[model samples]
Target: MIIVGKVIPFVNRKRELSSLNNFFNSDRAELIVIYGRRRIGKTELIKEAIKGQKAAYFFVEQALEKDNLDSFKEIISKTIDNPLIAKADFTWEELFQQIAKEEKLIIILDEFPNLITENKTLLSKFQKIWDEILKNTTIKLILCGSSISMMESYLLDHKSPLYGRRTGQLFIMPLKAGYILDFGVDSIEDAIRVFGITDGIPEYIKDVCYRLNSGERLEEVFQQDKVLFAEAEVLIKSELRDPTRYFKILKAIAFGNTKFGEIANYTEFPAPTVSKYLSNLINLHIVNESYPVLVDKERTRNRRYHLSDNYFDFYFRFIYPNKSEIISTDRISGFEADYNRYLGRIFEKVSEEFLKLNTDMLPFRFNRKGRWWFRDKEIDIVALNDNTREILFVECKWSSLNQNDVKHILELLKQKSGHLRWNNDNRIEHFGIIAKKIQDKETFRAQGFVAFDLDDF
Candidate 1:
């Protein structure tokens, strides 16, 4: 009675699947913790991993403890072919003891935070259960949740009772840019457009794909009454106690207030308050704090915050700001030009993903890659191999570039590379450009420059 749920077209989680399968096939008991933002496909990945195995998948709901326990009992009875389980009222530890009796089984408690929220002592109880009963058995226990904060504080944090109990942990991330093409995007340009909004999140990509297939204009998907119009607000409210404050902070960052002082001034919050809120958002992976590439993070005072979640960035930038207009008029006015400009940044991210996937295209394999900036100068992409003193500087453009334009950009990039203080004298320098379209790309390549366009993606 191990039900394999309806299968969807799984895309691009090869490493995760392999790790999960290895844990499933292992000789020892496994306590695996999987967590990510909502709709990032944690449950689907778990279901896909446990396919054809003796597994019981119980979605933990927010309810009374006894009510949830009864639901878990029912699932267990059907999964293990034991009618007595349906009749007996068992505690969490007792139920886990019964699960351990099986020779081999996978127990996936989806939304595990719900369980811990109802009964905080469940952490200590589960810790005891694992140590006393299930630790010696062949049970592959998977605890999954969407509340990244709760999951980390309750299960993954060093101070928690369940700390040191997890045999493995997987932080499920969104699919990279290349996977967007698998969703029936007609071209890399269309894919980049989709990626700018969805950020390669599988569920969001599916929604965009459906709308595209149904002939809905891309902008129309974010119109009033659409699925994603208010999704960012909803997700923020669900995850944080103070959504309004976080929304202000996120909006500030999305609108190019990346520096700490600027975000504080824009949000009108005290500096200390801003730091605390930013820390919380960073823990949830909604905000990303980054330093220049190859810079010593601890030593450098230069850092910037960005909305790492693309959908959130799009929401704050476009949907949230125009909610009133969209509701009244059913359209966004004057967004096309700004959206295209936003795609310039998104295309840079897409280009970075492309570089990661095609590292062989570079002159030397790079150990580190990221944006580099100092005062007035910035490079779109900088990749370097510290061991070999090899460096690559690249520019990303969302518009088509002809030969002259390409040369100008490469020349500017080379000049800016002079500012990066990483082994400047001994470094072997390389230059590259990625754009929407580049004319005569081979001609540039023959001159020892790395150049690519949408066609290469």
Candidate 2:
């Protein structure tokens, strides 16, 4: 297969692979768009999908139009056994036509946004090419990009020339903990310590696997990936005009300034400006503006901002804050000082992701789930099955807990669950706990409550 980047043993991509397989089997040409934030495995997935197929793989970088077009011509000509493309200069339209004419082909333009920036009119230029020459051909064209905001705005936006041309689209997200954990982490605890902070991005997962196996602490893994230090900076600069200000806003949020006014005050920008910057981040999928866990008819209430990109969040939290010190030495003393607290918080998020997929942790087909809090009470997990009137209340513990500990935490969960105002009288409630490891699984099961250790995930 023609691909870029190191070969990752692709896993848990059955659905995505099936979608691409359908496109490949289609009788006519197909135009597909795949995108996500960087290092979430978009290129790997495409490479896996197009394996053993007649395909042309072109990785578009930020360069002159002729440079990118020259690369594309070379790949297409090689894949199709046509030497003319490399022997002489060829136009983009002519190259595409020659590649698609005699064979069923898969054409992948990876990092497509970089190509567009080099030549703004290439979007319409390719659209005209497709409509005029390649529309009824046997080629399946997949345009992939890393910038979520740019991909959506330029290619998928209603006003863009390429808007109505796509046959399918996929937003490849960060892998979940369950999908990433089997990479042979030493233990469940190790998985959470590393995967929790890395947010299941495959490349970061690989880094963690290498670090812990080599007897390094989770904090030291951060030092190994020096390239990641500048990753957040590059992403913010690419998407925002004033990244210095944006960095402050993101750093403020990472450091527990989530409210709109708090972020504004922390960054010393006006609230509206904070909101506009946040919208840009949200569009880029770098930030998430989560409303309350439950759906509310009234839209403008209980909105909270969070950094959704795990690496960006970790970088802002750990790396960006101590840039000078980290640059001095690969190791940062006291890196583990606040690590336990951070692990506790992220374990809840990791458990929430596990609960989304593991039916054993949740029964009765839950329709909604997330962290929930009222005036002074916060529930680590609150899952609802509206049809069955069941609510699963859970607490995630990064530390080990025994039967007695579980009893106390379950009691606290019941107390906090009491504060939730949704369908209180009509809904049924069940309590549970997820820990790094639980001492007594059967003790809670006997009481008809769900309980899990990391092994269950």
Candidate 3:
């Protein structure tokens, strides 16, 4: 846990790091696949794992087969301290075989999809080499990629040559607000703002952390030409063949078009096409579909499409609309109206996490929890203590609510909870409110209600 130099120490990757690190001491050969969207820190995690150990990391890129072969030849040559190795031509299998002969190598092929894309047969080739040669060796092979769709289809699928070949696989994900905050931010408030933008992608967290440390303004953080600004654009272009159509669908969803018909109408794409695009987005972890919490799968028509993470939501909400504004002005004009409401919605998610973290405060342990809605009214946090026949209903307000304000909200919750109809005749009920800050929060608790503020979170 001691910092030796400039290393930021990977955050929220303890489990992953441990899995990879254990490879160093293992007595068997292994093939591990680590993948997710870009800037998700897969390469860094690999580097962290093999640090101070014998390892060869080749960052694969889109190029001719011979060119990539030569590139990796250089990497192997340097790692093995043999300049002569680079002077000769070697097939990838031969080069890998040579690398395996050198100590118990932690061999990482980053951007594995790039190699597969350029030569579709490379997957079968890898499978052949692994089964025939590498399987008997002590080398720990790790294939990593940012291409989620390709990685899933080409490696993890039952039809894939590499399927059932990997000893383990990790789908790296964005960090939660709490984990990112622990990594260091100005304050919890700034952490929330940063999460609103970065969604806890470590690379993005680093950028935001650096900017905040330098005392930069929000305007600069959101500048049109900033790295974070261009990230989504690049990702969209790479994953999507027709980025324009995908853009239209994504934009529509970000504009709060969650229903299939609404998104289809907004994007002017056919409903079937919209369904296909939404499925694609879901696969890419950009958007998700949610049904009312308590509804049966066969009976629900209220499925809502959600941009799966805060980063996408924030981008489509602010950056896409104000691209022109970003190009022209360096100043952020305001945080009024739409932006505030967006933050309010984000706060609901944040409060849910907060409630999850503070579960001990509940009167009973809840087995199921999610948003519940029927007709017009909705409860933001519904923690169902099913075994006890009780439900905790919470209303999340992004505004600063005084006890008086909270009391009225509570009255509304009472009316709203009556309609929940989840065995309501005999169900025990609990009520709560989560807000930016509650005036007289303790007093509300004394009044037999769960009330919390941002500080409590």
The global C-alpha lDDT for each of the candidates, from Candidate 1 onward, is 0.90, 0.80, 0.82
Candidate 2 ranges with C-alpha deviation above 4 Å: 1-8, 361-363
Model 1 Cα lDDT, one tens digit per residue, 311-414: 99999998888889999988888878899999988988989989999988778999999999999999999998989999899999999999999989998898
How far in Å is the alpha carbon of 198 misplaced in model 2?
A: 1.8
Query: lDDT per residue, candidate 2, 140-235, as tens digits?
Result: 889999888789988899988988988899999887766655566645666666665678788778766765666666666666355566777987
All candidates: TM-score = 0.96, 0.93, 0.93
Write the residue-wise lDDT of candidate 3 on 1-457 in tens digits.
1111234666778888888877667888889989998888888888877879977789887898788889889988988888988998788778777876765778788998989888999988999889987888888888999988899999999999989989888999887788766656636666777787888688887887777667776558878657877678788888879888888888888888888888988988888888888888998888887877788868877888898887788888778767877778854467446666777788888888887887898777888889987767788889997678989999998789876899999999998888887888889889999888889899988878988887886
In candidate 3, how many Å is residue 416 off? Answer: 1.1
| Collision pairs in model 1 | none
Off by over 4 Å in 3: 1-8, 80-84, 331-333
Error of 3 at 31 (Å): 1.2
TM-score of 1: 0.96
> How much is the lDDT of residue 409 in candidate 1?
94
User: After superposition on all CA atoms, how large is the RMSD of candidate 1?
Assistant: 3.6
Report the Cα RMSD per candidate: 3.6, 3.6, 3.0
Judge candidate 1 at residue 217 and give its lDDT: 79
Per-residue error (Å), model 1, residue 92: 2.2
TM-score of 2: 0.93
Each candidate's number of clashing pairs is 0, 0, 0
